[model samples]
Target: MLRADGIHRVAVEDPGSLGARQHLRHCGLDTPPVPVDTDGVRVDELRATGAPAVLLTPAHQFPTGVVLGGERRRELMRWARAGGLIIEDDYDAEHRYDRPPVPALRSMLPEHVCYAGSVSKLLAPALRVGWMLAPPAYRDALVAAKRFTDLGNAALPQLVLAHLMESGELERHLRQVRRRHRRRRDAMIRAIRAHLPGAVAHGAAAGLHLTVTFDGDFADAGLARAALAQGVKTQPLSWHSQRPGRPGLVLGYAASTPTDIAEGIALIGEALRRLGP
Candidate 1:
């Protein structure tokens, strides 16, 4: 919505999270769908949108798990140099198994990128703690908007987080979770291979979840509901699409135990069978 007020069009990745588009539409903004490739959002298509800015999850793409490749990173830097704004959501930038951590795009193009990150996955979503760093040009305005929205995030949790940061407890917790999460991730991958052999998995290199796609006749949402009926919950790939993409599921492993993950995958396997694959 903020983009609609100042910009003519917003470039959102096609087959991206539609929740983002719905929020923009609620804000009375028009979104133009842009294509994404293995490297991330396609730069040429983004430029074609003629929009001044774009939103991206370059560190770890939402459903595809594809990191923005090196050349694409340079391309994005060039795009930002041409006065393009980049809204960088550093979601789950910390968790990884097979790859080293990717640097935040904001670190390279801080002047052009708005970086938003939260503790939703780190500690828990109940914390409601997230930070945003924007260019100075937008800082004052964003602060004003935030002030009007809630005067500021609650004082106590902020202080507690401050203590955690200062005491290094946060880092300690992150290390602990990273170790545990890696095991769960492996378990989930194993489960996928055992139960859903036809599916393709993505983003297993990091983060708490794995995005899996399969060629099937059933709608992703229907499959999701079927899984839910069997006491398993998952997000359909369609929930993220601004435009049609594929049939798949986003299976989260971090919050669940290894046993639960195996059971859930088994349930999903059963659901798929009940639904005729």
Candidate 2:
């Protein structure tokens, strides 16, 4: 919709989401940094941007598992109420292990939030089937964007997804993945505890991945590159941050078995160890 409306400026979380910002920039949009706290995107900073729209993953914040606290929810509401657009990315809302499912912000402020969800993490990224619920104002334009982009997704996959949704199979599969993902989450947490004592883990209460930060002086990007060279791929926390911050890594456990998870964490431990005395 940014393309259709010619809206060039967007507000994103600082020390958050560099890939997203780069994607926007690739499309000729300027993404300004907004600070996010334990609550969520700092509304005051977001408001200060004066941008017309913002993107967020409110249910389970990206790179950090913290849920948007209630007070900040109201803050986000006020920001949207005051003519701000919210792009809600409900990416990993279902995999939550330590908490109840948080309701989508769009549910409360439909006209102001563009809620998006996909079966990628639930099933597999190959599914590539995602749904977006947008405000009425931008609905038509977004539909036009979808139509021109890929002709409304593949009809067969959409039909299959619809069948699963209607048959209760999708929900059942989710329950299964939820259990498996939780076990993997626990394993990763233990692996971190047993392996990387100095690293702080975040976003482990939910999602297929965990964020681990270290207090040491090594660059996260360098560590990630080293890990990659060692045959272990990880996303550097710095890769997501727009502002300077502590070094860290984002590790996915869903696709790997517990044995692999331990090995991966151990490998990361070895990599970090190689960086120091």
Worst ten in a row by lDDT for model 1:
1-10
lDDT tens per residue, model 1, 84-164: 989898887887778889899999988999999998888888889999999878887898889888998888888888999
* Cα lDDT, all candidates: 0.86, 0.85
lDDT top scorer: 1
In angstroms, the error of model 1 at 174 is 0.6
Q: What's the TM-score of each model vs. the native?
A: 0.95, 0.95
Per-residue lDDT tens digits for candidate 2, residues 1-277, read 6767767898887656667788889988888888877777899898888888998988888877778889999989988998888988897898888778988999899998988898888766786898889889887888888889888677777788889999999999998988888888888999999989988998878888999989866688888988898888899998888888888999988888888898888888898888872
Q: Once superposed on the true structure, which residue ranges of model 2 sit more than 4 Å away at CA? A: 3-6
lDDT of 2: 0.85
Candidate 2 to truth, TM: 0.95
